[model samples]
Target: MLYRGSCHCGKVAFEFKARLTGVVRCNCSICSRKGALLCAVPHESLTVLAWADDLSTYTFGNHAIAHRFCRTCGIHPFAEDVREGSERSAYINLNCVEGIDISVLSIFDFDGRSA
Candidate 1:
């Protein structure tokens, strides 16, 4: 299935193709605070549909992920794995996806705080 998503203010928009089986809820500091339900996909599977330049990135700890958000609304839409020597991937915030019935999808807990 193809999904469309954007930040709260719609400044950052994107689309991706994926048959989502589940989403992960991470307990890491940022993830915990943002309350994002993330679905992982290969970076190549994602396409920025609009206002890509309006997006801002934040990184912490090992800096392996570039958390992307809308500067205008401060909504985290997705994050990208930027680690060298690793296959690129994107963690999409399912909360931002249109028409998704999140309650129907399996939710997995991730102990990211200890990772």
Candidate 2:
């Protein structure tokens, strides 16, 4: 299935193709604070549709993931694993996605705080 998403102000828009089996909820400090329901997709499957240059990034701890957000709205729409040696992946914030009811999806808990 193809999914479209964007930040609250629509400044950061993107789309991706995925047959989402489930979504993830992580307990790490940042993830916990953001309260995003994330769905992992291959980096290649994601396309930035608009205002790519306007997006802001945030990283912390090991700094493997680059959390991308809209500067104007402060909404984190997605994040990517940028560590050179790691398998590339984009974690899409399902809350930002359009035309879907997240309540129907199974959510897996990730103990990111311990990782």
Candidate 3:
């Protein structure tokens, strides 16, 4: 199913077409601190509705992934271009998705958040 999610201020909106197959919690510094649950989707299946200029990008460590968020609401909705070999993958934030019964979704723990 496709899910529509937006920032708190509505300045940023996006849709991703995919099943809520599972969620991955990365132990990486930022993700661990932010408590973001990564929702997987085909990169091309995502649509950004508005405010590219209002979106801010953050990168660290290897600088491979560009984590995008709404500068107005400070919500990290998803991330793009995480791995160079598989640029077709983008991770969305399940926390921002509505109408989803997250308790039913399988959750995977990634080692990134640990150290």
Q: Candidate 2 — what's its lDDT?
A: 0.92
Tens digit per residue, CA lDDT, model 1, 1-115: 8999998888799999999889999999999999999999989999987664788899999898999988889999999999665589999999999999999999999999999
Question: Which pairs of residues collide in candidate 2?
Answer: none
Stretches of model 1 off by over 4 angstroms after superposition: none
TM-score of each predicted structure versus truth: 0.94, 0.94, 0.89
* lDDT comparison, 1 vs 2, better candidate: 1
Per model, state how many residue pairs clash: 0, 0, 4
**Candidate 1 vs. true structure, TM-score:** 0.94
- Tens digits of per-residue lDDT for model 2 on 1-115? 9999999988899999999888999999998999999999889889988764779899999889999989899999999989664469999999999998988899999999999
lDDT of 3 by residue, 1-115 (tens): 7799877787888888997778998989989887899887778888988765888999998887788889887998888886655556778888877788878889999998345
Instruction: For model 2, give the 10-residue run with minimal summed lDDT.
Output: 79-88
Lowest lDDT block of 10, candidate 1: 48-57
- Candidate 3 deviates by what RMSD? 2.0
Candidate-wise lDDT, in order: 0.92, 0.92, 0.83
